[model samples]
Target: MTSTPGERERRTSERVIALLMLLIHTRHGYTTAQIRRHVEGYAELGDEAFEKAFQRDRALLEDIGVPLSLEQPEDADARHVVDASALLLPEIDFSGAERRALLHAREVWSETRLQTEVMRAVGLLVDPGSAGEADDGLGLPRVVQRLTPNLEVFLDAAVEQQVLAFGYRTAAGAVSPQDRPRRVRIWSALEIGGAWYAAGWDLDRQGERLFRVSRVIGRPEELPGTGSDAPARPADWNPVEIRDRLLGQGEGLRDRVRLWVAPGRGHSVRLRGQAVTPTAQDGAAPGEGWELWETDRPAHDGLVQLCGGLMGVVQPSAADPDVVAEVLAAWRRVAEVHDGAPPPHPELAKPRQSRYRQGQRERVSRLLDIVGLANRAGGITKVELADRLELSPKALDADLRDLQYCGLPERLFPGWLFDVDAESDVVEVRQAVDLPAPIRLSLPEAHRLSAALDTVAQMPHADDEVAPAAVTAAARIRQVLADVGHTGATTSVRPSTGGTDDPGDAAAVVPSAADGGGAGGHEPPATPVTSFWDVHADQDTVRVLMDAVARHRVVRLRYHALHSDRTTEREVEPVQLVQSGVVLYLQGHCRTAGAMRTFRVERISAVEPTGEIAKARRRPKKTMLTPVDTTLEAVLAWHHRIRDLADDYAPRLEAQDADGRRLTRLGLLSEDAAIALAGMHAGDVEVLEPAELRQAVRDRALAALRRLETAVRL
Candidate 1:
């Protein structure tokens, strides 16, 4: 079976290239006959051999992130064309400055075990030479290792919303006792402030708690699972915030306290807003060493240790009779809390896991959002879908594949999973077989879905049967929320803007509507709110406008123009609704203006769909927000002493001289912005800009220096 040296390798390479070229060159899909006739290697193979080869090649192409599709031929006589988008390797879009940043990153990453893999990936994605240039020869040791195995397992379970049974090791090295299972519905696996922590409702504790992945004694065993019991993550849960709260790691005052510290040495505390003054004490020396310090009682143990040298209880006074009683009362409460328990292992209390797994939540959330959107739209075009999701076509395809592979445990069958169909020019997705019946819902999603169903019932020509079913579904959702202890959950429904109607009446299904078909003699289905509008939006108006936009329909609006200072009614073909800051603006082609205009949602007092569908037109990609001017450029020269600041603040390296001085160009909007930036990073940044800006910064610095000198004299 041995061939000439490199013959086999060369053949595969040539075939791969030839196959790519064939796929790229063909606009219309090529059938098996066309592929055999056109592709170089396929022509030489026999029927069965070609079948195996074609399948392998197609699979290989897809494995490398190519968007390949298989579809039934339109004509039964024709073989299926392997429909695929042209495979173009993504161009490295790193700017010169970004490249330099990556080069610095490469230097940092090179010290790790990931060095080889990172370099290989970088070489494949971008040029290796560019990545290797300007190595900052400071060889720092790797501090972060690859994610621990337990962290990965926890992350996988969290994404699937599965319950895991595991033996967690306590700080005392005691593992979970046998016979009793510790089951938890993993809410999230997070790396906050560089450590990994997995949080969830501890089925055993009946309350939420976190665990350190590193302290997990053994592999977490997946419990026999059902979707119904998936616990809700806390409503106001932020991994970092939760971790900080749980660890009691913040600067806060517990009680008013005063201390006397070594004078001048207490500047650290004084700088933190503590009032400091020379103490009135019985001392022989005129210039005493001790100074009175009054501040909030330092909350953290570290802060307590820092204040240990100080004379304590100055405010309460050690002589106060109640101080002893207060101390005893505090001790009694502590004794009651920790009476007979070996304190929960320190690891259990403060999980010190790595943060590499933090983005898992975002990935799962995005996947669900995509699925939900696709289900509502029935199908969406690939380009539009990508734009809505803010992803590249290639990235979309990759994520789709990820989605296709994700689902409930029952998704072992192909039909159970979400399916993508891109046979035609437009790509469509078949929603997962097990949607509308998921294991659990994030609270916000449940509320949103409930509101959407209510909106759907209000639409003209909506079936009566839909209302009762929707009501039942909404009740079940509320029950689910209740089951998860979210008792006071309310529907975030907004009123209809077309008419002055009660918000409650808006949710009630109407018995009948005036039956009149529009120009096409077909009544459009009522619009439902799809996009989560800004918090300040008139939900009713936004719903109507978004509905019109989705159906390519026109809407009549009573809008008050800020410039005109007048309210006028006008018909607009709602193109899209965009959010900027706290305001939602409807960007549409105005019949009155005869051009595309963006109207603030608040100004639009009324909205009524005009029943007329708009002719398809290309939407403007540009938004109303003007791009910030980065015209004010500065060349910052930094001394070697300020190398760390230079690394942090510099946008691009302009030059580095023999004396270890670095010059960097910083693009800014105005002198004010530059001044603010330089002031924030004062001493580290030397601005050499439009002489005026430089002079202003210099003057500000001198003024500050003069103030300090004056204070010293006083």
Candidate 2:
């Protein structure tokens, strides 16, 4: 009978563990012939099978950071030995504050792809029993950072020093069949401004370049040769500084630019600029009145592009005719695009395949932990072992059985490395193994820990407490990894703070000038950086809300509703914080509205505790955070160009039009939301059903055009 995948995996695990235990237990190590003759799995295999299995097991051990060394005596078969000292993680004492800060930093990646790695790293470093349960009182907002599909490809390339080739799209262009292909030797990978970026030496250009992960047109393939043929990364290389130099080339206006804003709109603009007194000379006011704001222009073409996106609400002052003309031109282009027939959907980039199975790595990690845990306890009960490791009884039994077969060849050693007394419900090691101490951190694990520490270090903290501790802890870990020859793993990639001028400002969405092609088929000037939405919320606001929630207090909020284009004040009983994609939401029972509501953290203009204790109430059922009710649904047709956004709506594809537009039914919270969605991606998205929504989108677009014309002629 053919063995199942489970049996194969168990056999592989047993063989690898047995080899490791044998090498560590015997100082002189074992030759291949001796290992094959003695190891249980190898003894049962044919000569050809034994060779492949032995080689695979050896590679697996080395890949996971096991310090396995090969030694050859003259005219003798090579011997594989485990460097016990090098395999152990060095002892680094952490202070109380540092420990708390480190734990908190680890918590930030709670639900992210890196969570498992972060947890494993923490488990190895901190004594779980002594490290008091992560303080839940603070209720830190959970951050969900989505890794780009190509991130692993780049990471592996960097670590292995390999060359990679991929199709790359520039900031000004979408992914197309005619995309320019580029080859690179990846030096580092980092996340900045909520977007992942790979920095490396462009092989074709013979210069360093940075490429946005999302802009990669297709899967990156590894080139045959290693990066050893290319120049090494500079000693002073810093991805952040290099990215800034490359992207921040242009200068902004030296003086402040005057802007007229409609009431309750342009919050992102307002937050950056100061409100100015509007005069009669400012021209005709729209809505209640045009609020005049003057703020320093951002670097490059950011100011123009920023104002262009807020055409209906924001207008540049006539004092600068050039700026006004540019804004007007942008508005006209948007209007023309909306008026024109929808363009065919752009070709979407193919999702890259992950290099390895996460489950496989996790399983290996669990097995290693078992050995370390069992060794530390001298002998642990099976029930206690299962509970501690969070494993089912069956799994525990299976692992024990695998461990029982792992040892020196039966001829060399009479018994297995680990002896399990199933009847007594006890697991004990019969022979000494160097694995009692935690193994060195793997490259991926180190990267995750480094990234998490970088995030915590950047966050705002009271008295600047946690930030300093995080920075110190990161440096210590980096040094430890480097000392252990894990230099590649120590490369830290920090997620940028949205590149905002004001640190306190929440992540804002600045529309790309090239989003809508202009009239006459003219391409807009390339943006300094690709448009990206930051996922991190304002730390100050999140901290206050968390406090209120912990105290069970009623809080007053000044929230700006995007769909309605209005700000409202309401009292709410703080409940929990929820993170979905690039948006953070505060889910609570709204006392003012007498209903459960989810408020976007970015839209919350102000949060103040009312000092009123909230009444006891049952927690609301967990639901996805959306602006509107799910019961009301809207049918929309969106071109594949904006498929990423469409995918967020849990869309059911009804049909595809000739233009490659997909008709999808999506849930809507309100009519205004449907209109806002269509208007935001106008020309790319159309309201297919609910005739009223289509008309509303048209009216909004026309009104915006009229407003732009009025502002231009002033």
- Lowest lDDT sum, 10 consecutive residues, model 1, at 503-512
Error of 2 at 508 (Å): 8.6
- Per-residue lDDT tens digits for candidate 1, residues 1-714, read 879744554455445434543453355555667777666567779999999988877765553334466555557444433333223222335544333333322222211222322232232233334533332212111122334457656755654456888876543234577667578876666432223457666776666666656557567888765424445554444443442343333335244444444444444344333654433331111124545555544332323222321112111222222432343233233223222322111111222333443132334434554554455455656666564445578867766765554442221222433466534335445644323211133443333333333322322211223324434444454565555554332232321111110111110001001111010122111111111111224545655765676577888988764322345789998776654322356777899989877777656767898889989566665554321346677666554333323332325435654444456665665665555444433233456545666666655444433332332233
**Model 2 clashes, total count:** 3
- Span of ten consecutive residues with least summed lDDT in model 2: 516-525
**Please, what is the TM-score per model?**
0.31, 0.79
Per-residue alpha-carbon lDDT of candidate 2 for residues 116-136, written as tens digits (9 for 90 to 100) = 567667766655444344344
Clashes of each: 6, 3
Each prediction's Cα RMSD? 23.2, 7.6
What do the candidate models score in CA lDDT, each in turn? 0.44, 0.61
Best by lDDT: 2
lDDT of 1: 0.44
